[model samples]
Target: MFMRAGLTIGEFSQITHLSVKMLRRYHEVGLLEPDRVDESTGYRYYSTAQVPNAQVIHRFRELDMPVREIKAILATPEPEARSALISEHLRRLERQLDTTRAAVTSLRRLLGPASPPLQVELRTSAAQSTAAVQAMVDQEEILRWYDGAMTELDAALADACLSQSGPPGGLYDNALFTHERGSATVYVPVTATAPAIGRVRPFVVPAAELAVTVHHGPHDDIDVTYGALGTYVAEHALAVAGPVRETYLVGPPDTADESAWRTEIGWPVFRTGIRVSG
Candidate 1:
């Protein structure tokens, strides 16, 4: 009987580098059924031809591919359909890898010695008319929404032949940070407001006094600047209830080099007569 069955379960496990336990689980899941079974002892056996399939499953599992997805890939007869499924999983893995790298970079910066104190200033901004896009958005989706909104604003300005008077900016409600969802606005200041287009519309940006600090480099560590600025406001100024404003003086839209980026983070405040400390 052993001579008739191609390989015992243990033999197949050794050749495929898969554990006997995993093979059993795969068999139970109908992922890889045995080629033959002994009627008397109910022993499982696999053919030598199944070695390649087991190895392929092992490689896919190493890449963290789901068993279900692997099954789908195997079941699909069309080469293109199978390739598409694998390609999509690879893309998802790439996105996860990118997020992990960014988190690692941020962690390194945070664990290093404290940097010099942030230089904060108090300034008054006057009311200005602009073309803007506003929406209620989730925190996780803000970046995507911002990119789309800014692109539309730029095209609308170009179509109307209007020149930007200042850098593009955003106003984010406090609830956005506290509750992870809230009203957000992205705007480009222009000499004259352009006609409403899609989510973009002619609007006025209200004036307010702000305690501002410039955050240099990529936005990955921008929260550090926001924290420092908030500390200064709590100590020296009267904090007002309003949306937080960010001015993208030099950003991805301006340069691909993140080190060259400059963002101005402003907290709404009422100026106290106290002088700014370095």
Candidate 2:
């Protein structure tokens, strides 16, 4: 019997830098099959032409691509389709990287010296009518809901020929934070009456006295500011049971730079001349 013209599995592994064990696992998963298999000895042989293919698989694995996805990429014949698959995976990796960066930033801020005292002011907000969208949203879905609601509010105002009188704001029920799900209302204040359309409705925001603080930069670390403001309210003022308010003073609509974004976080409060004793 004549042996096939190919490098043995060991030689292929040495050239590709993929461990022999990994090569066997990849084969088992149908990710990267050997060019030839000796029927009698069960020995695997790879062609020199498959070197680039093995290298490509190694790179994808390093990127944490799933074996199934790598197999799909290899099986795809069209260049455009293969590129699309890779691009989609790259996008997912980018999102994961962003999340990791944000978490690191938060951890560093927490571990560092105590942040400067929060600049909080007591202010009264007057009742106003606006175009709004309200929904019961889970904490994990808050960002998605906020974006959709804001867009809907914008479109509703435009369709009604109404001019926005103030920056966009949101009211988040305490249950949302405490229980991970609750009512959420986002609105765009308008001078004229807003007509009801779709999820957008004419809603009136009641007046309230708030202990407000400005959270600079991105929303990722906004919770730190929230904690500071809560502490301040607990120490010097009386907190009222009401939905928290957030006004986007300068946001994504105004600038692509997240560092320039400023959000006003308002905690409902009632000031009595008495400070709480701990």
Query: How do the predictions measure up, each by TM-score?
Result: 0.80, 0.80
Pick by lDDT: which candidate is best?
2
lDDT of 2 by residue, 1-278 (tens): 99666999999999999999999998898888999998999999999999999999999999999988998999999999999999989977886776777677778888999887778878889998988899999987787788888888888887888999999899999999899999999999899888889999889999998888999999877887888889889877579899999999999999999999999999999967653332
Q: Which stretches of candidate 1 lie over 4 Å from their true place?
A: 1-18, 30-60, 68-95
**What does candidate 1's lDDT look like per residue over 119-177, in tens digits?**
88889989888899999999877877998999999999988899999998999999999
Query: Candidate 1, TM-score vs. the true structure?
Result: 0.80
Q: How much is the lDDT of residue 215 in candidate 1?
A: 91
TM-score computed on alpha carbons, candidate 2: 0.80
